[model samples]
Target: MKVNPTTLSWQAPTTNVDGSLIDYELEYEVGIAGDSTEGDYAPLATIPGQLRERETYVAPIADLPLDHGEHTIALRSFDKAQPDRMSEWSEPVTFMLATVPERPLELRVT
Candidate 1:
């Protein structure tokens, strides 16, 4: 994805019977199919209050375990009433981790 993970936001699932969603868990692995497990994937943030259809996760870059390179991102919705009861993780999203490019200097017209 071209968008930044730190600024990434997603919508909640409607076709789930996992009661009410409490939080949206964002996890990521270093490489493709690296691992989506709790230990393998470093949890970025756990967003609470699932009242809104969508939410924006403010995960600082410093929180990310990976500094750079391709990675896999996945999301899981946790049940509100029951913490253990949660929905399955959504399909993984392929993303590239790179440093923000510096701004150009000395602009000139051709």
Candidate 2:
């Protein structure tokens, strides 16, 4: 919300249907959907091989800055092992930014 310019806090991915939830992976991309020639997904940031399943993982948005529009963040579940066994990225979460409106030309009292 509000074009998260600061760190984004998200709940760790819940238990997977297969029952393997060791580490968490987060990736984000900031841009218009139509701009992408291949796919909408862009590799913005990545946090892999993370340990300790914390309630919330704070990912800084400095790298992936968002403009006045909708953006999506994708996440996945990972297991603590070499060549990590990861799950397909979870449904992306969309965020929006508020646009600044033009100021009033003048004020009038009627």
Candidate 3:
């Protein structure tokens, strides 16, 4: 997974078995694990479309509050042909939103 100023995107996993492509689903979570509540994450978003061979899937930037701490993000892929079947969740990625100092110090010269 990769994160920019406002977007977090990744490549959709390819189907291993023979099956028709249907759509893609993206899910994410923010905040420290175990200490965070369910509301801290965004609901899963579904994109309806067929996946081209060797094509990459990308999702739009999800709006989230910038808090100072380590945040976790996760994603998974689902097959439309088999709605019940889903790929294993990818490795969780961590990002930190640092807090900026309120005041800047001035330097004095003799």
Number of the top candidate by lDDT? 2
- Candidate 1 lDDT at 59 equals 34
Task: State TM-scores per candidate.
Answer: 0.55, 0.48, 0.45
Give the per-residue lDDT digits (tens) of candidate 1, residues 1-110. 65446643556554446565434442322222445454244455455543243353333444545558776766666655566755556566766777788799999999
Candidate 1, after superposition: displacement of residue 50 in Å? 5.0
Q: Rank the candidates by TM-score, best first.
A: 1, 2, 3
The lowest-lDDT stretch of 10 consecutive residues in candidate 2 is 25-34
| Cα lDDT listed for each candidate | 0.52, 0.53, 0.50
TM-score for predicted model 2 compared with the true structure: 0.48
**What is the alpha-carbon lDDT of model 3 when measured against the actual structure?**
0.50
RMSD in Å for all candidates: 5.9, 6.0, 6.9
Task: Compose the digit string of candidate 2's lDDT tens values, residues 15-96.
Answer: 6667865444433222323455433555454554342346666656655645666766665545544325555655556677
State the weakest 10-residue window (summed lDDT) of model 3.
26-35
> What digit string (tens of lDDT, one per residue) describes model 3 on residues 10-89?
66544444675534542222223344563243434454433323465444434454455666756655556665665555
Better-scoring candidate (lDDT), 1 or 3: 1
